[model samples]
Target: MKREKLNEMKMKFRALSSNEGFARIVTTAFIMPYSPTVEELADIKTAVSEAVTNAIVHGYRSNGDKYVSLTAVMYSDGSLTVSISDKGCGIPDIHKAMEPLFTTDAENERTGMGFSIMETFTDKLRVVSRVGEGTRVTMTKRLSVFSK
Candidate 1:
């Protein structure tokens, strides 16, 4: 079903590990007016952090020179959708990559839980990628408004 978008925002930043926090903060600020609960906010932040970190570490292979783009949309039904895209080496096997404890960089002590964490935090998660091209991770969540 299609929902009317109340607001939208897009940003592009260098694919640096340090920028992961920046992305999370920006996403939180964007959704603040919707009055999400503390738990909801934390979940979104964690998913955003994982998505951005994946774009920086796996997509770009820690190449700070690469770029990642993030787009967020707020729907009238209190749902928010966030998409993160990276113009770097894409996932060759998305299914295998998303499996638990499946890390291509095990030598780096990577937990291989990024996708799992994102999936757990968001209501819906979709990933699109092409080898040697790029990858885009889209996540959506329905926010339960908090009242004080």
Candidate 2:
């Protein structure tokens, strides 16, 4: 069955490392009424952090002038969908990029596990990108313990 969207939020911000935490905090606040379990909250926050960090660090390469957009939707079925996008250098190979420990920024000691962690924590993960354009990562999770 299709789930109706209960609420949504969209925000665009400079692709600064500091905004990663801001994104997570806003996301958490958005879902507070849902009463998600501690584990679920942690999972969502971690996944958001990874995606936002990737946009700032890898997508924009810390240039900070570019923008990253975050969109979140809450569904009637106790599910949340969050998408983070950046207008920066896109991934050349998404398949390889999603591979565990496969990082393009080894020089910066990046673990290359951002996608992996996001996948592990979310119920669904989708990534779209163009080589010279940008990348968008969307993740969803069902909040089984949420208050209806």
Candidate 3:
């Protein structure tokens, strides 16, 4: 298959509960045209929601003063790349965070499954973080003609 490069879309929103839904909606709207099925849309939206939720709940701790950034890029091969980041309490151990049912906050019934869900939904997942700095999660999926 020939690779085709497309433009990228980037947006940043405050790490607030209300903005989470907006982020998911905007992302879905932008990628929906290339998505093949409703299942794919749900998957993408859920993955994005998980990422944003993590940023708001874990990263900003519901402060709502911080900001979360999202970026989407279409590759030449019809692959979609998404990046969600927050400058908050960084993950101490990414491997452990990615593990299912491992959450630092359990009192809230977090389930610690956010990372796992994101991983399951997207074709690729990458996380970058510092102890006290912040975290960046990038996910990718191949967009096929049948995806729509």
TM-score computed on alpha carbons, candidate 2 = 0.96
The clash count of every prediction, one per candidate, is 0, 0, 7
Would you estimate the TM-scores of all the predictions? 0.95, 0.96, 0.92
Candidates 1 and 2, the one with greater lDDT = 2
lDDT of 3 by residue, 84-148 (tens): 99999999889999899999889999999999999899899999999889999999977667344
Off by over 4 Å in 2: 146-148
Compute the lDDT of residue 111 as modeled in candidate 3: 96
Q: Which candidate achieves the best lDDT against the true structure?
A: 2
Q: Which pairs of residues collide in model 1? A: none
Residues 1-148, candidate 2: write the lDDT tens digits.
Answer: 6789999999999988889899999999999898888999999999999999999998999988889999999998888999999989999999999999999889999998999999999999999999889999999999986544
Question: Where's the lowest-lDDT run of ten residues in candidate 1?
Answer: 139-148
Q: 54, model 1: CA deviation in Å?
A: 0.6
Off by over 4 Å in 1: 146-148
lDDT winner between candidates 2 and 3: 2
